[model samples]
Target: MAVVTRTEPPPRPPRRRRLLYRLRVLRHDPTAALGLILVVLLAYLVVAPLFAVLSDAFRLQYGDEVHAGQQPGEWTGYYLWRVFRSQISRLLFWEPLVNTLVVAVGTTLFALALGGGMAWLVTRTNVPGRRWLAGALVVPYMLPSWTFSLAWLTLFKNERAAGQAGFLQAQGIRTPDWLAYGPLPIVITLGLHYYPFVLLLVGNALRRIDVQLEDSARILGAPRRTVVRRIVIPLMLPALSSAVLLVVGRVLGTFGTPYVLGLPADYRVLSTGLFQSIRDRSTGVASVLATVIVIIGIVIVFTDMRLMREQRRFVTVGGKGAMDRVSDLRRWRWPACALGMAVFAVSVLVPVLTLLLSTVTRIPLNLSTFTLDFWIAEELPGAVGFPHGVLRGPELWEAAWNSLRIVGLASLICAVAGLLVGYVVVRGTAPRIAAFLRQVSFLPYLIPGIAFAAASLSLFAVARGPVPALYGTTFLLILVMAVTHLPYSSRSGIAAMMQLGREPEEAAQIAGASWWQRMRRIIFPIQKGALVTGIVLPFISGLKELSIVVMLTTTGTQLLTTLSIGLVDYGYTQLANGVVLMIALLSFTMTYLTQRLTRSSLASGLGG
Candidate 1:
């Protein structure tokens, strides 16, 4: 017995035992297993495409053998030189880069001022119609950002681009090219479109700032300006910085507004420049541009994170709830209300009304020329190839159906996947796997939509291993939309789950409920509101998405966005406006219905 005991294996070391215990737990725990699977899937879907794009930038692309004097797939830095150092680099990359930086910085500043001012008015002041202004101001975000560009064109188009003269030009007021098409209009339109990002973020931050802090500063005999400068702004630095980063990141990637407003003036940003390269089949250059955009986006994201960490010292919120004190602007209340209404006029009412007017009349804002021809006429005059009104055309109806079907299915997939991801992130036993899944799911948001679409094309255009090529299929469109929009649903899911306790699942487990049963009966039912918000948010976003769709859609897989852009390319302004209105209507209807059903809103969902 002594000899047998002596020969027995020694007890495992403490660290090794802990590792073995973790392995056993992961093997047995269903949540841990699901987390592991999600990690692998997200890595493939999110990280692999990025790697593909980076590799393509450094490799000799097809037909570029002549240009690079190297074989395809071979490593070369020719694209780097062509985009950054070559003779044509000024036109191809440097100018676009400069223009992009200018527009992005300008848009960020403009959005900050407008949105921050509005947020302060509504959140911290006795501004008349605060509730109405709060909701109305967020409506612009629901419509496509390019909607503002279309409206801008309707009001200001000059003789630069060959088509219909804009309202101003038609009225014998010669709209300057600077006002009609270039950085000015681009910044104005984009800032208007994205200001809500700042509003929501800064509004939340303002609401959280303990009024006592500001009141204390005032009690200490600080002047109003000093109080704001010393207390309010420092407390607001995190939100301000976050909003700046968010707007800048969006401006960097937004393709439609720049394309519509900048193209006529040849004011190319990186996004439009990349689009041009892709259209030219300059794959290497496109890859390099896409890579650069992603790198810039990554830098922004990291900077945001770092600033957030550094600004933690400014936190003044405490365990006790603080009252929100409203500043009195007794005589200025009406003026503040008027200001809010003016913003609504510019950001929402004008754009919607302008697009509507453009669709119904050949000459926008000219009531005498009103007709239903663009919407319902059996045949459209002077519209060859697309001979029917948008309502009467097979193309419009088909594209609408495709958009609803593909985005619907994709949103459903996103909702379910997001819920599962949340479940794993919150309940899984494997911490490392959960964190990896969390991070990888968010990576898509960092990459510009066009770059992500390009990466997706590079990765899935051809088959690899057991996966078949998905180049021209509707499945690819659905897949890309799902991945690109996953962050919204995933964020909503995580936020919802954070408030959920584990008692229900634990009780169900004690009652002999299977993992699926617990999830289906316990988790799903409780998260219904979050699930709906997740689904509808992505549906709204993907329905109007153009940059991603433009890169992936072929003739067979055309979405409403691409359909509208194609009509624009064909110079069918009224019909394009009609399609755009249809998109806005659908998006608004979906968001309205979701909010009504779930008692949740775009602002709250996006904040999460």
Candidate 2:
């Protein structure tokens, strides 16, 4: 025994062996391995482009080399100085930043007010048309964000912005400059488009609230105001915060509406400024503006995270039996119904009707001028860019197919990758890896789409090792869309997976099933609804996306959105509106079909 002990137990496994053993253990854990890979990939994809943009901010870019008196690719602070301290800084940075804040804050408030009221009516009160209102109100979100802007212009546009006066202006209505463009129109358009985010989030939370809590407070002789203030509002804080964050984050990066409405009015927002810089080939300045936008976005996100931390302390759900109670509006039921319908009208019906009217008329809102030429004629004589009817051209069909193929592939990748990411984050053995996956997957959401597009254009325009130059390629478009839209799918996947217990998977493992088999048979079957939700939301979003595809798509790879914008550029208003209506219809039809087939609405998909 002494000799055996003196032999050091026949030499224990080396440190290398222990390390290898640990790696082997990780390899056996598919979740850990997949999570590590996802984290690494997302970090490279998300952080690398950001670094490239940041580097550009300090380097002498192509056009800036002459201005800065430095060679291209050399380090310099000329761009930052120009953006922050130069004579034009107010126009280039400060004013735009102020305008951005105004729009963001205004849109958030307007959306929250309208959306929160509707959510209360539908989820809490005995509103006469609750189901109809619930389904109809979200239609605006399915349409392009610019849909309302275009409608507003159609109704209120004066000679300032272009070709012809709008319907109201044409009728000798003096639409004020403030009403037609700038902050008011931008806020109202964006508010209508984004209010559904609030409705879905707040409505979902309201539905999940236990009636007993409010009832208990009421039984204790608490006033209605107190019950709402102390019980309802506290429970609603998380949803309200989430809704506000979503709306604000969107307002920060949204380019289409601001570009369309603000360009004519000289109303500049950060997104518009970034667009102008990129368009002018001022990469250095563009990077600086982009950096600022990213900083603001990060600040907003951090603030939201802090609020969410506080939200954790106010959990309302308990083990006790919970019932949903609807407040009887009595004489106010019909009025509540009217109010809900009015929201639907402003948010959905009006914009859609205007778009449709514009697409069918040579002069929008003029019945006598309406014609089918834009939609079905053999040729549109004197139409500069679109010489034929929108339906008669192969361009429309081909672009539609490309949009479907490219965005469809991207969405499929998003769904699968998101599910994998969720699994790793929720079930992985390594906590650090999980946390990293969670954060990196969400990184794209904070970067403005235009900035992200600029970054992609810069980074992917060159080849690095195994990855080829992806500029002007459909693959590049697919990749960018997938990465940018990954947040929706990943959030949906994580929510679904968190509700799933590990017992079923453990049972499968005990039965000698492989990791892939367990996931295929047990995990996927249970989370199919979530997978569809993830896929559908991105598909809808990508189909109507204008900002991302605008920068990345070339002539050969035009999407529906790019096509629509091109028509707009060529001043073919009806053709453009036709394309837009098609986009809205496609998005709405797909969303409706998904809901009918899967029994999952946007509310459910978003965990409302």
Candidate 3:
């Protein structure tokens, strides 16, 4: 070798120094700085409470002496053991665990059956009202999950559950115990509510499928059933899993349905049990249940996601433009229309009609009775024995106030934070770290409401080194709402950022402008509409969120969603209905506002 050993080139200063310089520039970059600030703020709001909850579970409280003097702050498996191994274990854990599984499985099956069938019928066969039914089916999904629960109670509640009759009772039918409560009702309600998820997901899948494949099989003498079984189902696996997972995640943390149906039968699911544990001031048991719920959610979600990714292979196979739809059956059109209408009636009209009926009734169960007392009664000091009526009450106002403020604040937090996070993720130079943060933040999405709540509970229980306890504070509510709503926010944020290209910012930088100069002058203005929509969405979702925050706090600190549950629990049906009405109105109004504010921008951003 030639003695001319070239000295190795000195390594450039570590990226850390470069990173600091970049960060300094970012501080000046309004867009970049905005994103970074949001991440920290969100971390504080969302992550801090989680740590507080975790610490609370592990640390000792007033009743530490009850467990034979097991000191507080001492590590013990007592809570876990009690939940899993104690004498009342079945009531606390086993029984509800089964109920959870049954409800989850039932929800998944119903969603698939109803959704998949409709998807197939409309997309492949001569199904009547395919176009109309396709859109109508999505309406229930558009409404919050509890919307159905309220509607279910409004219609099916009998003397056993509500102490008042339902719409059925008014029509001279004693709704059977089976129809009135427990697993069947829970499953039916959740399924009906979520089936639209399946319809949309599977319908999209069906719309992409090639008709030629089916025709080819038929031309080869393959039977209709054979082609469907061999080709359609397999092709549907990905979309099917997506729908299943969505429904499963939804049903897992579902507090409203079980609360409406199961509580009367004394049927317990994890969500209800978690609520009970919290009410009794049993933080440890509640957190543990929350964790298990999260675990179940994770497993289902993991499977669902894997299948979703696997779906990428089923791209539009043919070069032809649009996929063909199943033509309407001319002769059987009436029958097909009837079937579709029946489902639509049950899922949409019936539940809402039931709510309308209940609002005007004095008693929920008995027939041959009617009154508008709940809505317009001015002087029934003892009506429903509540503190107020539907139109007026300190409590009602307080709840409405709480829901609006919290949901509004939380939504704003999520939207702004999500936009920043998304921007950072899409635009950051440190690609790996950005991706890591994005995914980690989204880990909560894979988490079920109960589980994510448990994580927050477990994460925040202790005061830790710097973060303080937040167990019973309003801050905890804000934290959980923000975290639970992160997935939605981030999705919108990332999409919006992607749409707002780098060229404008680059032009600013190229003109000797600092990063902040460009962001203030260029980036934010262009993306403001999209960002606002992101913020607004989380608010909408948070306003109606029930399961995740359900066990996290108690009365006075409760959100409207939780308050509704409490009212129902205390036999305050009218008050609960009032709470629901308030939520629906707020949600609808906000959605309408969002539409008006971003009609043009959103349509462009969404490529509609």
Mind giving the per-residue lDDT tens digits that candidate 1 earns over 1-608?
45544477887789988988988655435786687788888888889988988898999988989878899999999999998899999999999999999999989989999999988888888888787788888998999888899889888988888667789988899998888989999999999999999999998888878888877888989998998898888888998999999898988888999998888899999999998998898888998999999999999988998998987798775533454668889999999899999999989998889989988887878999988888888987677868888998689888998999999999998998888898888887678887887888888989889889888888897898999999889998888899898988888888889999989888987887777788789889999988887788889898999988888888888889989888877777777788899999999998898788877665662221
Give lDDT tens digits, candidate 3, residues 142-195.
Answer: 556777777777777777864445667757878887887888878988898888
TM of each candidate vs. truth: 0.92, 0.89, 0.87
Candidate 1: TM-score? 0.92
| Candidate models: Cα lDDT each | 0.87, 0.85, 0.73
Two-way lDDT contest, 2 vs 3, winner: 2
Candidate 2's C-alpha lDDT? 0.85
Better of 1 and 2 by TM-score: 1
Worst 10 residues of 3 by lDDT: 599-608
RMSD of each candidate relative to the true structure: 4.1, 3.6, 4.5
- Model 1 misses residue 238 by how many Å? 0.9
For model 2, which pairs clash?
A: 204-608
Rank the candidate models, highest TM-score first: 1, 2, 3
Give the winner by TM-score.
1
lDDT of 2 by residue, 382-474 (tens): 776679989998989999999999999999999999998889888988889888888888888877787788887767878877989998899
